[model samples]
Target: MSVRCLLPLVIVAIVAVSGANFKRREFKIKIDGEVSFKATPPLSSGKTITWKFKDLQGGVIRVMDFDYDESATPQNPLFKNCASADKKTGELTLHNLTENHSGLYFFELNGKEQMEKFPLKVMRVVQKPEITNEKTTSNPDVVYLKCKYDKVVDKDAKISWSCSNDTTEELAYTKTGKTDLCCACTLKNDVSQETSDQICESDLFHEGSNIALTVVLILLFILLFVVIVLVLMYRFNNKFHDYVFKKYEKTTCLGGMLKNLDQCRSGKKTGVKQTDVTTVYTEVNKIEENNKEDDPLTDPQHDYEEPQSGDKQTDVENGTPLKKEDNTPTEHSDDL
Candidate 1:
């Protein structure tokens, strides 16, 4: 063969060998599951790894190295949802994965040395579909029923509803990826006792919407009542005061004056009129004088004179006699 013909074979062989060197991986997980991708061996010095994701929509997303020393942070929508990677071995850990995470994952080493491709498929299962409404409708003979559950994005995940485990008839269901499903059906009022509220709870009892709403409404009402009471207390300060002087004394100090004042105001004091009493004066040393000159009743001038300073008394016969109105001889009465 010529050199040109041999050159084509060499290029074809090189392409085939390079394709064979790529590592392919398959990972199957449920929706909202977590997974980790670890490097088989530690990376060499001065060597870094990068991760890329290609979704079914033909969109590509790239993630930076695990070592923060290379870059403090990288801008990627999936990076916020994924876990950090190993600093030494460059292993990547993903967390809280959703159906949107299903895609082709690529791990490149040293920018070109080796490429590891991972084909990931996230399968979702029903997490106990909720029974929204299962009650009698306006028509007495007809009853209404409803149910809810998470959205299923894949075609393989089957969502359905049934009654009493009977396959004689199938219940109609609508599927969508945007929001959780809500389906309703009408039945006759005469339902079997086995397919009552108890069995419906077994179908979907993860929530009690009516009970939760009632409790929330009660709490809000109580909060509103408390707020109104506080506002009234603040506005009508004089009407509702902490200190009620009418019921009790606001202040009382220790003292007799205050005690008397309280007594006087309460009309507890006794009453009495003040009057002057008669006082009698007596002469201690003076004796009754029978002589006309010394007798206080006989002579008004003798009553006005004071007695001698010392304790001396004169006898009626020895003292000088005063002149009487008539010159009668002085009789020495034995009584004197």
Candidate 2:
């Protein structure tokens, strides 16, 4: 083989060996948390270690360099006091992490580049969740609750609910019952988790106040309806009575009306049977006069006394005599 051909074969062999030594790892940590990466095929004596970072945008930066017996010195300001290295294991540790530190970390052994990579993801700690409640209008006994976190720092974070009855992974939960069942909410992520304060069912519903208001309104409506009915009935009764009396007056005579009214007052029936009859009256009167001849005066039957012009008299009606003016003696004979 030519020299150039031999050189290409050597280069290919070297690349293949280096690829076998490469490693990749992944880690997730919250802000202010600690994480460490161990070097593969642990370092030997006189071997130097170098750690570098690659950002999400493909920007590379050197983090630190150290030997087995010497302490690590960081080159980036971001990892000034936050980076450390173990001399024995050639391990790299980082603390006080932030979102800006999320990137790929690489390390070199004996000043030779190695493809060993550690993908780190820095996330914010989960905050305490907040819970809010709403009563269902269609059913007061049912309450709807929502678990919320105001400032969500991680897109992969999840919300869950825990109650006396059961646990749920939904952010919104429906609770039912009048018991003192309590519930709490939790916000969780790959790095950390937090829980909210517990809330009870009694705090969401006021059954007593709602029931009292409904009862009072119903009573008021019933009372108003009763009053209106009574007023209408009173007016109708008075009008009916007047109408009946006017009808009665149109059909009967005044005397008959008085008779019927009296019978009604006495609690007797006013019905009367019809009859037909005829009546006549005749009058005959006898008068006595003094006899002008002396011969008639001798008889006892013809004896009479003369009436004076100034004397009071009596009047007769139906065979009964009544004095006119003052007490006086008068006689009459009549036939009718």
Candidate 3:
């Protein structure tokens, strides 16, 4: 055992030797609880009883005093509101205890201190422990469990598991059976103990169902990844298509411009030749004379209509010559 485990015994032995008639008791109480200590050989009508506290640092402070026929007077300001004494029963009750109130307590009869002493220890209640299922065996028939309390408040606390097999270990394994198995975790200390909620062993160790769920999750994740990849590829393909189209349009425009520039350069190198307008007019006049030779009016079987009076008058006013087969050609004027 550690020194801390043996310290109480050492203190008890020392006190035994110092006070042969001393009666000592160790007490454990939760925070905000109450404790009552009675004086041996209860107080008489005229007797006086006093309570005193000795702190962990060996400093003593008077707590309360009671005189059966006189009055009850409290001394320590720290315990003024929390301490009370029974004048008839010679009992001192301390309420609202805290860790700071943990220490030795002494009682006095009349003017002399009593041999009985009380050692008080104040502590908080233990919290519930958690149990988890662990996979420790390759066999599907076996189930492994681990019980733990991470936020342990007491140093002397113990962790244990209560199962159908009655296990005391923090880590325990058991075989699965036809019937349901239940388990719980417990944490215990010198002051208090707490037991966790029961868990169903078979439900917790559903290996086959767990495997199926894991597979489904993995397949879903793969499908999601494939979908994301496809979406990215589609967006990239559209951008690539747009880029190629724009590049082709630009190339086509550049080629047309270059072709036009080459044509201009060729024209500059080989000078332009102009056609004569008089040759074009003479060809037109020859075509007109050939058409007149094939005219229906010159044929002997053809009948021609005479010009109207309005048409003759308009032609004469405009100084236009009237057509006749026997008429001679007119000379040109200087203005023409």
Work out the TM-score per prediction.
0.34, 0.51, 0.51
Measured by lDDT, the strongest candidate is: 3
lDDT of 1 by residue, 1-336 (tens): 899899999999988876664433567776667777766555556767776778989898886554424633445877765656776777776777777888877767766634556667766643444345443434332223443433442224333344333222233222222223333222211111112122233233334566788999999999999977854553345444222322333345423332333344234323422211111101211333336567677887874756554535555797854443455556765456
**Residue 163, candidate 2: C-alpha displacement in angstroms:** 3.3
Residues 1-336, model 3: lDDT tens digits: 999999999999987776654433678888899999888889898788888999999999989787887657675677978888888888888899988899999889888998788889888878777776766547765556666665546555676667644445445566565337677878787678989887775576676578899999999999999977754453346564334434543476854543344344335556633433234546988999777777877656556777775564335567776654445545664447
Candidate 2: what lDDT?
A: 0.70
Clashes of each: 0, 0, 0
Instruction: Give the worst 10-residue stretch by lDDT in candidate 2.
Output: 276-285
lDDT of each: 0.52, 0.70, 0.72
Q: TM-score of model 3 relative to the true fold?
A: 0.51
Task: Between candidates 1 and 3, name the one with more favorable lDDT.
Answer: 3
List where candidate 1 sits over 4 angstroms from the true fold. 1-24, 66-72, 113-115, 129-155, 158-336
lDDT of 2 by residue, 93-195 (tens): 9998888899999889987877677889898888777787766678765666777666545457776677634344433344565447778887788888899
Native-to-model Cα distance after best TM-score fit, residue 235 in candidate 2, in Å: 43
